[model samples]
Target: MALIETRDLRRVYDLDAGRVVALDSVSLDIDKGDFVAVMGPSGSGKSTFMNLVGCLDKPTTGHYRLADTAVERLDADGLARLRNREIGFVFQQFNLLPRVDALGNVELPMVYAGFDRRTRRERALHALGRVGLAERAHHRPMQLSGGQQQRVAIARALVNGPSLLLADEPTGALDSRTANEIMALFQELNREGVTIVLVTHDAEVGRHAHRLIRFRDGRVTEDHRQVPVDARALAREAAE
Candidate 1:
């Protein structure tokens, strides 16, 4: 079954000014292990789609299913539980606590999930290692480079073993080199069977995904599979 499914999904906001249609009858399916990049200009419904798929928001007039569970049927608490278990979010800002070290930041999710201290430590360490940051676990976010900090954030998102990784312009804060490194990491993770849905305005970053989905004026304008560029190779080429 597809990891994500939406049919005639729509989101409308009743503002003081008037009603704003943020999403308009969008329908699509994202298969397990697919690496999809969502692209659009500001106010083009891409963010709205991400929010709905991430269980962060509900569609006002349509159906959505994540791993076959009907999203609209879930209560607020149920949506929270689904998000906690099935989705990992990576934001452009990294969102790390200034006072906490990488290990501690990664452990926050598990703590909320009621994991014991030992298990949280073990899992956080493993997650850091996955992002090639095991040695930086003791370092605070301030001490790490931009790429390293983003890596830590990615590790935190993965610590819960979520079925889907939803990244919002994850490479936006980095330089080209750093962004390429992060994209390489994402490609590597996707090859390891982690389904990823990335929202970005950068065309270079979007080309690294196996599929491209473009939104415009509250509708999907394009959706197609493509041969992804090799991000790791591009990074290495830049280094040379």
Candidate 2:
């Protein structure tokens, strides 16, 4: 079964001046281990779609079945529980706690999930190692470089071993070199059987994904498969 399936998903916002449609009859399916990139101009419903997929918001109409569970049928607490268990979010900002070290920040989610301290520490350490940040686990966000901080954020996202990774403009704040590095890490993770859905306005960044879905006027205008550019190759070329 498709990991994420949405049929005629729609979202509308009521305002004093009537209603505004943020997503209009959108439908798509994302399978396990697929790396899909969402692209669109500002106000094109990309963020709205991401929010719905991430369970941060619900749709106004239509069906969304995540892992075969009807999302629209879930209550607030149920949705929150599902999100915590199934989705990992990486934002443009690192979003690390300023006062906490990398290990502590990564362990926060597990704490909320009711994990014991020992298990949380072990899992957080493993996640940090996966992101190549194990050496910096004790460092605070301020002590790390932009790339390092973003790595920490990725570690925190993966610490729960979520079924899906949702990244929204995750490389927007980094320099080109660091962005390439981050993309390489994402590529590596995708190869390891992690499903990823990323939203970005940058075409260059989108080219790294196996599938691209473009949005316009609250609708998906284009969807296509592509041979993704090798981020590791690009990084190597830059170093030469």
* Candidate lDDT values, in order: 0.93, 0.91
> For candidate 2, lDDT tens digit of each residue in 1-240?
578999999999998999999999998998777789999999999999999999988999999988777999999998988888889999999899999999999998898899999999999999999999999999999999999999999988888888899999999999999999999999999877778999999999999999999999899999998855345543443564
TM-scores of the candidates are: 0.93, 0.93
Specify the poorest-scoring 10-residue window by lDDT in model 2: 228-237
Model 1, 1-240: lDDT tens per residue?
678999999999999999999999999998777899999999999999999999999999999999879999999999988888889999999999989999999998898788999999999999999999999999999999999999999999999999899999999999999999999999999877788999999999999999999999999999978854346534443564
RMSD of 2: 5.9
Candidate 1 lDDT trough over 10 residues, lowest sum: 228-237
| Clash totals for all candidate models | 0, 0
Runs of candidate 2 exceeding 4 Å displacement: 228-240
Q: What is the C-alpha RMSD of each candidate to the true structure, in Å?
A: 5.9, 5.9
- Which regions of candidate 1 deviate over 4 angstroms? 228-240
